[model samples]
Target: MSELIPAQQLRYSAQLLLPEMDERQQQRLFASKVLIIGLGGLGSVVASYLAGAGVGQLLLADDDRVSLSNLPRQLLYSSAEVGLHKVDCAKARLTAQNPEIAISTLPKRLTLAELQVLLPEVDLVLDCTDNASSRLAINQACYTQQVPLISGAATGWQGQLLALKPWLGQGCYQCLYPDWQDSPSCLQSGILGPLVGMVACQQALLALQYLLNIGVIPFGHLRYFDGLQGTSGQLQLQQDPDCPVCALNE
Candidate 1:
């Protein structure tokens, strides 16, 4: 792994010395590639941490642009970045934060076909998109590709995270939400500015842990958090024996 990444001095030194995560874990993160959808609130934070930790490649995808309203929470963008493509803005900020990171910008919407083209090359998929339709598409793609998916949502101080390791014994995202109903986007409901960053950064932490092969998986369970109350917790993970995807595979 050290041979894979020679830029030791550029980044990853502090991570190697961290108590639970050793040099091996740091090297693992350095060698991994991750794809993040929607370079907005969640995606911005996710990109920051992964690049900061020195993920070898980042497939940054988003078709939106920074707007005046986005400046409150989308730290990757500034007043100057408004009207610029989200992926370009994100790439500029993330690359400047760590020049060693290999970041690619795809400023386009993710159709099922487009997702299939991208997901296979990525070691892991992080869904930072705002809508449930996009989330389910990402989930199904990962399930088919045998890739792990890290998903998080935040709106108005409430947020949750769920991990779908399809290749593992755990169930995929659709298995957990089999009904497949569409949910309200943050724009519709009006999200709290800072909470988006919190949830996104948390998702990034879990992503890094998974890539580094360190923390325990939150399979079949959801971790919920409320920033207004300063509270957080996890709920039980129930496997559906009749889940269309997981059951058939099992």
Candidate 2:
């Protein structure tokens, strides 16, 4: 509920010269509160980029700790942090990166009830988390709150990014993964380190664009990238008429 932190002192050269960005858009981004549900590979980059870009406040929720295998991606921590709580370490790194922004770290497991409690205070929600249960909960929260949800997933050499804004006519995450069944994650398939960063960065861009409501167009379609052979493709995603979340009224 606090006022948005001003970005005038922290504006970077890239944002200053961007013809598409103006003071109003920058302020809107600064006023946005983005809730990131993970502290792993994708969540790490998304948090770093958004904080560096001067987002106003952050509601960080992660119930994991740094592990030996997480070294390659989760860049917010050092080797010494192998046993420390992930959200604790991430908060320290992010605050050091830009103390001007407000950060609220919740090092607790989040359920649908918890998400709904936090949903109303934020503008956008980014699901960098790796499970369908969490992603589905986030989708429902966003749809019910009329907040935009930017979702991303990565495994091996494959990556997917989609933004769901039910208030604006786009489909929710459930529209794509309706069954919402639990599936294998990077930990199971071994994701390439860089793939997580790329996917997280795209998620950040989508979140910023949605918050700014600038000239940026919503990616109504789904994007697929094959890091193996450098091949990528996208196919338009039609709104499922019977989607339980995106089209609950029907």
Candidate 3:
């Protein structure tokens, strides 16, 4: 591992102060690479935290453009960037937040083949996309590559997070939701701004822990949050023996 320069030491001083975080851990963070899909509500917060935490390289993928409607939960953009592509706006903001890290932008949706090609170089992936198709695709790719994945979602003052480590021989996102095709979206159910942030923060925290090999990660577990009631819960995810996705891995 490369030694932390004076600049890095100063920049990551807060993290370095943590008992579990020393120069070596800080250096590990600097060496890590993360791919964040969807530059929407969840993705925006996850990207900001990971970049600010000094992740070495960030690959941002999102084909959608910013809009006035995104302003509520997607704090990464402003009114000035409403018409621009989300990845472009996110790249600029993330770069400005931590110029020390490298940001790569993919202003398009990725196909399965494309994800396979990209997953090998990535250490972990964050599935911040709101749709089920995107989530299932991401889950399949990460499982195939044996990469850790952190998936999150929020709607109507509620949020949920799930972490999957394919190599751990646990349940995947597909196993948790076998029939993900006809799920309701934020557009129909509506969502709260802070609800997304809360979920995103948890996703980011789980990613950091997985990357740094710190605390125990709830792999194959679904964590639920109810902002309206100020309560939370968790459920252990079960792998389906009949799951087609899992059969592919076998």
Top-scoring candidate (lDDT): 3
Give the winner by TM-score.
3
Q: What digit string (tens of lDDT, one per residue) describes model 1 on residues 135-232?
A: 88887788778888889888877998888776565666666788877676677778876788778877888888788777787765789998889999
The per-candidate count of clashes, in order, stands at 1, 0, 0
lDDT of each: 0.81, 0.81, 0.89
Task: Select the stronger candidate by TM-score from 1 and 3.
Answer: 3
Query: What is the TM-score of candidate 1?
Result: 0.89
lDDT of 2 by residue, 1-250 (tens): 3433455634554785688776666667777888998989999999999998889898899999899999998889899999999989988999999887898999877989988889998887888787788888888888888777778889888998887666566776777777767767777888888988888988888877777776564556778899888988877667778887777466
TM-score of every prediction relative to native: 0.89, 0.90, 0.96
Model 2's lDDT to the true fold? 0.81
Each candidate: RMSD:
2.4, 2.9, 1.5
